[model samples]
Target: MVVDSRSRTRASIVESAAKLLREQGADAVTTRAVAQAAGMQAPTIYRFFEDKEALLDAVAEHVFATYVSSKTLAEDSGDPVADLRAGWDAHIDFGLTNAALFGLLIDPARGGGSPAAAAGLAVLQARVRRVAAIGRLRVPERRAVELIHAAGTGAVLTLLATPPQQRDPGLSAAMYDAVLRAILTDAPALPTGDATAAAVAFRAVAPQLTGLSDAERSLLAEWLDRAAGAV
Candidate 1:
């Protein structure tokens, strides 16, 4: 089937805007610049997005959509640390690779400045809740979620801001060691790579507990792909 030009134009404009935000700062994504980047007129861009704020929200949404890529996440159900290692790896990988998306996500001047920012953040926080519910977080689940979120976000932000040469390897496990470890006190009886290790330490079910539709999982996988190997 032939694609619709208007829909194609709209996607192109949002993509261009996201590109500009990533390449520059969020302040740089004017409709005119996006239109220019899209090879369309400014009014043509306006026809799709209501205004710059709307465009920015779209950009933010797109950024999130990019982070949760598929590929099945190869989850470890045994050791909490193993599950965490996988998640932390995935999380930071997304953050560092999509610096532009990361910028829009963490930067207060961009989507963070908008009223809708809380909604976007809540979407991510909810994901952490899923992980916390896994058996490893024996302490209050809420605090475990908080610690994990703080650690994951902090690590990603630090990685994004820090020069590659200076990033800390120890920082990678900081949240799990400092926070979750307080609850899951036992030194692992199993090895990190053992197939049963992650499961032994964690709940049988996976952490992304939205009962996500296959479509959602597929979208998330694509986003993870953008994060590439940076994490």
Candidate 2:
């Protein structure tokens, strides 16, 4: 019973903090303000969170987890490239809609060890893996993942810095296209004479290579990844 009560209280505090963050931005999420919003004393927040930063971390994770859940719930469209584009669109929309939370999630100091941020990256990696498996990825999976992630972050930060009325609506799409061209091949299957694409295709299937020891598989993956990155 005590555990349940504590969980409820913690959840209430996080929800209240999330609401403040969503509506009024991060500056408005002071402990005193959050406590008042949650109908509790400021000290009660200390009982649940170590400091304002900790509370904000919880709020970020809570909100981002909800958003991630929505992404996971959606049915995949069977086209890996199209599915990746959809994920990118959703990411941009989420960043725009939750500016304060997005800012918090992207902060290098805090985001480095954040589970929420890691989960988001994992989703991107899965999408990239799907593309690699289909022989469309030209670069290594890790390289493709990094390029897409960096581009998306740059696009969101750029748009957020610009005044709403002055922002270019085509900027995100253009960035995605540029990233796709860098990381993906025109052909749906691995093209002959394209060493990078062939390496990437082989890397994608390395895990399922039969008759190979685990260490052998790992070495093969490393070699293939290096070959893909060389191009």
Candidate 3:
């Protein structure tokens, strides 16, 4: 792939900002500092990014991609719950090790606009879908995804806010177990499984079903919701 000069410059700027974040924390990633680190003038950064926040967004994206690339999840492990556990562990580790970047990505002001944050959510949704496919999810897939995300993010932020020596080492694990207890079935979905769990699993993959009109799908979704609530 031929890397153009403009792309190279943008890449250098993002790299510089990422380095600043990783080494000096979030407060140190000023536009001037990033420009100097990248061996470019301050105005050059403006030409690439609208503002410092934009630059930080790019830096978060670059760092996230680099991290995810190094620890790419397997496409499938034949056990969706196990895959979910692996992903939870990786997410906690990533947040702890990249506090500055993680904070930037998880800031409520950014909502779901950050590319890195969206990518992380997509991964969670995919993992949840896998569990739904096997009929083990006890909650709607979206609900399960949201719960896991909230729990994982909250756990990391809480731990980060505490002094290292005072932090409970079991906090993250306990949170994960709590989330699992709320969202998963004791056994895989079977022909004679809990109706609520099975309904929730079916709801997760409902959109992928074929030969259904929009109205039919909507009606089916309502029925699934009612069924899932029976638990």
Candidate 1 stretches with Cα past 4 Å from truth are 1-3, 69-81, 107-135, 187-231
Residue 113's lDDT in candidate 2: 80
Sort by TM-score, best first: 2, 3, 1
- By lDDT, is 1 or 2 better? 2
Residue-level lDDT of model 2, residues 67-172, one tens digit each, is 9878877788999999999999999999999999999998988858877677888888888888888889888888888898999999999999999999999999
Better of 1 and 3 by lDDT: 3
Q: Flag the better candidate by TM-score, 1 or 3.
A: 3
For model 3, give the RMSD to the true fold.
2.7
The digit string of per-residue lDDT tens for model 3 on 1-231 reads: 345988999999999899899889989999889989999899999988999888888888888977665445556678888889999999999999999999888777856676656676788898888897788887777789899989999999999999999999999999999999998888855436488777877887788778898889988989998887732
RMSD of 2: 1.6
The lDDT per prediction is 0.61, 0.90, 0.85
Q: What is the lDDT of residue 82 in candidate 2?
A: 95
* Per-residue lDDT of 103 in model 2: 96
Worst 10 residues of 1 by lDDT: 222-231
Residue runs of model 2 more than 4 Å from their true location after superposition: none
lDDT of 1 by residue, 136-162 (tens): 334433444566667778878877678
